[model samples]
Target: MRRFASCSLILAGGLSIVACTPDQPAAARQPVFEDVSFRQDYSKKYSATDTTLALSHVATDRNGAVQILSSRGLLQPYAGEFLYPGTLVADKSFRPLRDKKIRAISTYRQQRVYLDDKAVFSNAWAGTLYKKHTLPNAKHFAGGKDFSFLVSDGKKLQYLNDGIAWEGSAPAGLIDIVYDARRNAFMLLSPSEISVFSATEHTVTTFYTGKGLTCLALTNNAREWVVGTHAGYFTLDAASGRQRGTLQRKLPCADLTAVEEINGKLWFGSVRGAFMIRPDGKCNYYACKRWLPSDTVIDLAPGADSSVLVLTDRGLGEICFKSMTLADKAAYFGQQVRRRHIRHGFNATLENLEAGNLGTGTLDDSDNDGLWTCMYLAAEVFRHTVTGADDALENCRESMDALERLYTINPMHGFPSRSFERRGYKYDSEPWRRAEDPEWDWKSTTSSDEAIGHMFVYGVMAELMRDEDLKKRAVVLMDSLMQHVLDNNMYLVDWDGKPTTWGKWNPEYVNARPAMVGDRKINSSNIISMLQTAYYFTHREVYKEKAFELMTRQGYYENLMRPMREITTAPASADDWSKMLSEAWNHSDDEMYFLGYWGLYRYAFNDTLQANFREAIIDHWQAERPEKDALWNIMTAVTGAQQFDLDEAVWYLQEYPLDLVSWKVKNSDRGDIMKIDTNFRNQHTAEVLPPDELEICRHNANRFGLDGGNGGATEYSAGDIWLLPYWLGRYLGVIGTPDVVKP
Candidate 1:
């Protein structure tokens, strides 16, 4: 998906600037692709404290309903609107099975069969006891064609047909039983080999032999059986019972514990997690609490819908796949933002979620409230520009009001506060300052990242929003903020008339660090962009003059144009501030740089500076390729680059987990990745983990971080984390409209 650049000629106040069109026609834009179908995971987690819910096996009943078995009894799937739990089978009116400890279960034609120590029962026969056998105990059961069935109790195996019990040459150490309709036989699995009991011949024969075998399942095509072992799994010839190939173990998880073929795909449950092998030979791994109640999977089964049921020791995980487009996902996240994340018109997090329950969440404040609101407001602005949606416009207006309040709530001249809260409720104590209203307090010591983010959105709103009121307000704020810096010697002076830490853009402060330090390049880049945006909107001579002086006289141009590769750890002789800043790559600065690129390139004083800024932006994006961040890639598309990793961008979007709860996810103990020694960028593995496989985080965090979360204590907002990149991609024509397709 590549497109030629489409430019909009803007003539404002006797100045001309050409910017990328956000609402260009599809005919002039090449589509990313015909919005194809992708898998979206939905999980249901159970508590770990309850022993009665310790499931061991899962299978569908005769009515195609899921039934899980444990030592206590059976349970069924319980569903709700968003998040839900499971239900006890006895509560669903299974009176005869209320208190019985089920050992095995099977589904026959129009009947659900269960077995205990000495009796077999059927739900379709209007009686609990369908037959009585002399078996001391039964643990595994399966049904063959007609009334044929088999039962095993780890040592003894027996066959039954039409109520006649026939003794067979039983194999010791029996582990499981499955019926092969293609062969009209019963397959008995042990630790080392498989045996087939031919119902017609009334004899047992060796089917296949293997070591460390645990479980097996017949394929939907009826041509092969997938056999699982402690190491991995392999396919078997259904007719000849011959092994297909060497055991294949290269997977997201080895140590296979159970296997099931559902919907023409092989699904596996390992000691670590569960995975489904798609038709492309790639697996979609489901691990961590995000996708399961526990990582230790016990069994797998086909559920009522096209979903798969993963039974773990803790509970059941039902993963349903839905066909959706990026536009559809944006709409879903839009609703999610409004429902739970909005706090006083600012896009905020829902914290203190008890056990990942959304109903128990409370809207919380953050230190980057202004930055978060800027990104969310920009998303709505792009959405409204693309579709003219009324709700998007209203969201933009409301969030913009909150942003405007950041400036007015504090008494400091043109200094925007980081966030505000009701009196005595300020979460953090260090940086809070009382407001004149006597009922509120606003955060002080706002950093350079917030400053750049505010300027970026103000510039975007001024150029793209259709409402004149918003446009004028954005211009006024842009000028006021820039004037504050210009009047304060290129620094954001706080109430104490001193430069705040990380808010120093003065030449003396920025150039004091070595060339390799990131602050040198980031500060130079941000200041120039801020100055350029102020000039572009206000048409003031002072903004242009100040920008020129910094670029030519102060050596800021060379600093900003430095190659991204040159940024490394500061020398040992450097001061503590510079060394600490260069200890690892500051990903937060990446956020600031990309946000500043909007103003850096779009509102450049001339095309020559814009061209150099394009190179800088692309260089930063190249360094960030391993992360495959959707927002960075999409923002780099603003430079009209042909190859911005569009495929990887789509992967990032599609693989993003729908549940944004900050659940504790551990991937450092995984066996699939090739861990490496720590480096400057903290690259943990050869390839970064997929979005759903890792803990949910914001764009500013390192994507390579292996393990992090708050243990289901918080839920992050999708407004800035997801919607902004999606809408920005749509605005720049890197992503196309949703295709009309069936789910």
Candidate 2:
């Protein structure tokens, strides 16, 4: 026997108190909030300690301690601790140092300072420090295994090898020099040219020429160099000096200041931030307050394996590329859902509250609150099924109760309002007013979208949840809603005793339209799935008989099998319904089709018609690939379609930005993207806007739209867009479960 919590009574509208017993099972109690602290801990554990000195240069010593050179002193991290300031020679202007033969060479006001593991040695230009008794009057230095080169006043280049000195002249307007040990040569850079000087051959040759050159680094093979210019970076062949293609995307900032090769990846630092270009050409950008202390990146250097040390004007930051995983990401987002996204018992479609706190505003009251809440409940149900967590089960129960209230709050039997509130609850606009019941308020004109969401969650609960009481409640809700449609001629009757605008799915309504109308196909597909799910959960033969009747007489199965390409807009018609239904392609229909497909493919059909359903699903999925929608791909995977891109699904999860607030994002001025022709049915451009530049998006939004804004009135929640795909991917075995220890 399951344990139940105590019941309570509450007064409504100053009437007599009424008994309100919330049937919460013992296993489904309130969840204790856990701090989402992984990212913070990872940031703290990997970042470098703060230093007060104004740092000018940074490099990694052989011992893996990052050496810091400031205007007045030197510092180095000691044995995984904070940077310890080292003693500075008085009145000396120190040039940046380079590691050579497990030693670092630092130049102090025309004097050479050689630092090894044990001690630091200062030698004047006239002193006998090595076989060569003279050091060049240089402001910059580059070192190799057996030679050290210096650029004096950025023009005269001199190299010391085996106590012998060789001299060369840099191109006019020289800026910096670096040694490529693999090629046994020194690369000199000016504002617009690169010159490679070979000390052995006593020759200097211009390697590449381009305008706005700022920084360069050789590849791991020493066969090509990555050149960072003010515009963007590209690769140049070291031997032929020929330009390769530009990177997959331009760096975040145009004023490139530093570039380095770290663990086979090219790290570029610019005035805006730092970015890493993998060998496969995928770019990962790091910037803003979460990833860096400041946006002005000074330099980038390699640290311990796979870690890159970032130098900014404020301080140093170290990031380990492999420290984070997908599970950690899921945990963080899950907490965001619980904290900022929940309003009352429902999930807010648009969260306008401050972080970690709920706000008092009209934004919390959304028309589709029940729908979003149901989707979130489905995600938690899947999570509970996968992990067997008590908290996830509790969350699902809470959302389920909220969804049920949408039906019971309205006086009309089995008619679910879009949303409901107390009589005094404030609403700013239309669709929300006092219901027929003077003590309550409800949103009217609820459409088919709400019906789809309610049925989807009801079916999932009946299948996955273990509680017997909840299962019985789901059955009752399904029977009530399905019977309402059946009794009312297959149309959802609204509170006004008439069919809602989009709730018509009867044969007379759907089959009267042309074959090219999307509504005809979508409505037929939805009603079949609804009847099939209703029968499967309720064990009612009426639902199964109705499903068969529709398939045989109404031709719903044939309607659904029509190829997606054939569903195009027809010519304008005289009738208003026909004109509206055949006007253009509706992405809302895509949402309805995929959501209904959960039941259409999963529970509706047996082995006989499975192949036909699979064909229809694949046809729709193939047409949607250009949008690269993760939700559609993961949903289609339930039908065992091998053509779906699993890697792209993971990329979508990872590339989704952390900012969940619905900020206005505009991209009309971007230069890197392409434009395409637009028609009434197809509005997608040639290329998708990069994820970072897009607004907080939902599955229903136009994926290829170039400009979007949320009106700043509400912030969208990521619960459906992110949590649905992630959990569905887990349920289908397409995404692996990480070793995440429960709190």
Candidate 3:
């Protein structure tokens, strides 16, 4: 669950840094990928939160298969039992793609490495590189506060933390370091380089001479490691420094850039493509261009413990690591089945899909298409939910609770509908201001509380796919929102005797003349989606009727979906985040656009969205969009390269990087409201912070919430997590499970 940072603006009082300078254009940015060294360094950052975060160098799936992304932007599928989507990524990218296609995913657990704090040293995230803040450094830090960046000088591990150093030695040519919980030593990997150095044995006595380990990564077992080189891919003994076996790839000198052992087999990537070498000497290869993208392999990355990111010359991509294996897939299937049963009603799922039921009710659920969307996903999507795993049911429960809290909230204090229940309603910041009125500049008529709920609602549903009880509750909650809207005709808009509710920013854009809509303006967000799905499974009229009615009213999409669906990118300015987080920026071309296309897509897999409105969205995207850096641009480039077309959404992702602000405007600084004004705020969190508060904020922004919680303010927050459930859901799957929706 994420911390709901109050969007309340303080409006004054704080050390605000103008993040961007007016001298530069709003879209200005540098190329992130232009630097080869940087591209090769994607593995530098380890975040359990990054679902689509990519590492282009080496990637794999749950089945220990490899995925080789080509230069042309196509995805290559491998022949192996994949337990997850992309590859098995861990704090260590546990396994690389088994040669561009077949990959392996880990059933996460506490991989304890017995480290002899005295003899050998290793950082959990990155092998020991420097002293981290404290003298007797064991401090687990997150965010940039104590974020460790490691680069080896090829002999010993050097650490950098708070201007101090914690030095430790490893085997000669120690290419990779693994935490050995059993011996409490750092295991080094190189062809002939496996040594359990006790701070005394800096050199290796037992070296597998025949191996030339060029690339290395850790595995689920801190005691073991995945090693790749010109010789072949293989896993080695950490304690004994013995070769387990040669990974069975057919390539003469398999350029195994990545490797992971899962389901009792080996997976690795080479120059030409990806491959999976079974224990029995069988194999599977995922040819880059032959399947999708070009043949050039670049970099690979793994996220948290969930998604796998693959970086190529074009852009980055994400895939589930565990979904590629038989065990994890079976486990994921069981979890989804349980979740489906837990859902209050399966019919509700269909009802929402066909009818649409969000943005128009007292009981709010931001992700309108939850029902059908969940249906669109594959069973393997819930792989992380298997009974016993890292960040398991506890994660799902906490996430659901946060979403429920979001729905019950009322925002803007007493100036508007201060109550948490009707929290999203806005007030007349500037009365007599009307979109139709010539003098009416777009003014804030309502709070974006509802808009931001997209994160909570979508996150809840995503958690449901993995958790049973939460999934059922989520469905029922969606059903209730739809019922509320149907009973009240105008789906949850602030039509309280007002002619229209004016808005300034769409959820994803900012600065330009803001857009306004009638109080009845609604879209598919807000859990209304469960209706169609419910109807489909139950054959109930209420669900279907309300869904269609909601759709008819919210038919004209707004700015939210545009950015929500826009190619993903990091913000270039504070204004950009504010705009992106506003309801005014929710500019979807139109509801009917995706609607018609969705139907068409069900039948025709290659259908393209040519609606004039979609084109308009592209125009709007380009007009107000900012430029991106190379790393960020890689995403857009992939989109451009994949869809075979150049458009605004793709371009934004491919070229924009957040601008550095010199002038900071924090929501809490100027806020005169109760400290609760701290509600719905941005930047202000950084302003009001004492050293303690800053420490907490640092926690909120880390790879995973190690302190506060997964969704802590300084840990997990609704804002960042929102991007994962909503946008990623579409690209990944909806209720349309991969097996069931292949239709």
lDDT of 1 by residue, 307-408 (tens): 787888887788887778777788888999999888889999999988788889888778899999999999999999988999998998899888888899
TM-score of each: 0.93, 0.71, 0.27
Local distance difference test values of all predictions, in order: 0.82, 0.67, 0.31
Return the top candidate by TM-score: 1
Candidate 2: TM-score?
0.71
Clashing pairs in 1: none
Name the better of 1 and 2 by lDDT.
1
**Pairing residues by index, what is the TM-score of model 1?**
0.93
Residue 402 shift from truth in candidate 2, angstroms: 0.9
Q: How does model 3 fare in lDDT?
A: 0.31
Q: What lDDT score goes with residue 662 in model 3?
A: 12
Residues 1-743 of candidate 3 have per-residue lDDT tens digits of: 01112222211112111111111111112111111111000111111123353333333433433333232111333221221112223332332222222111111122111111122222233444323332222211111123332223355454443443345543455555433444434445665655443323333344445457766655645556667776556666755557686663444226656554433445454554444453555443333221213223444444334444434443333332321212222233334333332222110111121111111112222222222222222112232432234543444454445435433332211112211212223343433122332322222233333222222343334343645666667556544444444443423334243322322122221213133321112233222223433443334566545543433343423432334333232234434543443433222222222222221111111112113223433333232223211112122221212221223332322111111001111212211112322222121222121111111121113211112211111111111212222222223222112322210
Output the worst ten-in-a-row residue range by lDDT, candidate 1: 19-28
